[model samples]
Target: MTTDAVDAPSGRSASFTVLTTGYTLSTGPGVAATVSYVTDGGRHVVVDPGMVAHRDRILGPLAELGLTADRVTDVVLSHHHPDNTLNVGLFGEATVHDHKAEYRADQWLDRDADGHALTPSLRLIATPGHSPEDITLLAGTPDGVVAFVGDLWWRPNGPVEDPVSPDQAVLRASRERVLAVADVIVPGHGAPFRAADALL
Candidate 1:
């Protein structure tokens, strides 16, 4: 089936909206980033910045919602994949936070550098399967808990696997951790789902 972009608000809260930037699939290319945004009290945090092509498109719709990248106080990455972290540099002063294991100097999140604190509502869980630096963000919102699983799994299609990959075991364990706590699942490249029991 052809892919299309989708956006849905939390059923429990009217203030938060989840936007999907769609995915890019070509002859040899895999899926692109599925960026997610969280808005709380005028503060914004972008989960998984994705690549440059998706960056502008991701931020474009925000303006219509009365939000802008400049207003983004935090950039939370689910992992260190280029598709997820490429546009991190776009947010100049925004505090970038991610799994300490996957962080790089060039990437947005630099502990030595100044940025915003990790919101109490959000917790970072290290899920290393797709990559050693892979992680998932658990957000405690008024609507419920949302887990942004970057590359850990995809919507409808299920988990993306690499048989010979070293972190296969860790990936499975990580998936369990996410499934046990998240009420909603936001994959790295598809629409958000309300599957509290689904796991990779």
Candidate 2:
């Protein structure tokens, strides 16, 4: 199947201890997950760990920062898709978080509206439809709110956009939700791009 994931582009930094994975993944060419990081000084949070087969590529950025998997404080999966969540086990001892709904049917809580806190700044948003449990992370950095949005879609015709999904309405709604809020978008695929007032 054609997927939206593209090799993350290089030389990009977002805000508040976050760095974009330049062409994330070691799986040859057209396929890759644009993994990102959100660090709070001492603690490191990794987004979209990518495939377990390409763990090194996902963890490579952390390595460059003089960190190993043990240094990771949290592993946040945007969803359980193999390209995004397969490497969570590599972050030894790090707390794993995802949209709670993935595990249960009831108790579906809206963390964003409930003022659920992740740090002093990071807010968890439940954005379904890419998969039922896709989560978009919003970190309040000095620059502005940078959102780590997983598999919402690819850039404007750059490459990859699944023509149909099981829940097209939900995906569009979730994408709109992110666009309404985030200043910078670290998409599941492609390079980090500006999203505030950006055409969907």
In model 1, which regions exceed 4 Å deviation?
A: 1-15, 24-30, 52-54, 101-117, 160-165, 197-199
Q: Please, what are the lDDT tens digits per residue for candidate 1 over residues 61-140?
A: 66767777777777788766677777787676576777662243455333421112245555566677877777676666
lDDT for each candidate structure: 0.64, 0.62
Candidate 2 Cα misplacement greater than 4 A, ranges = 1-28, 101-115, 156-161, 197-199
State the weakest 10-residue window (summed lDDT) of model 1.
Answer: 1-10
Over 1-200, each residue of candidate 2 has an lDDT whose tens digit, in order, gives 11111111111232443333434333235556767778764557888777533567666667887888888787777877777776677776676667762211233333332223456566667777767777777776767677787776544222233453468778777777776666787777566778753444
Worst 10 residues of 2 by lDDT: 2-11
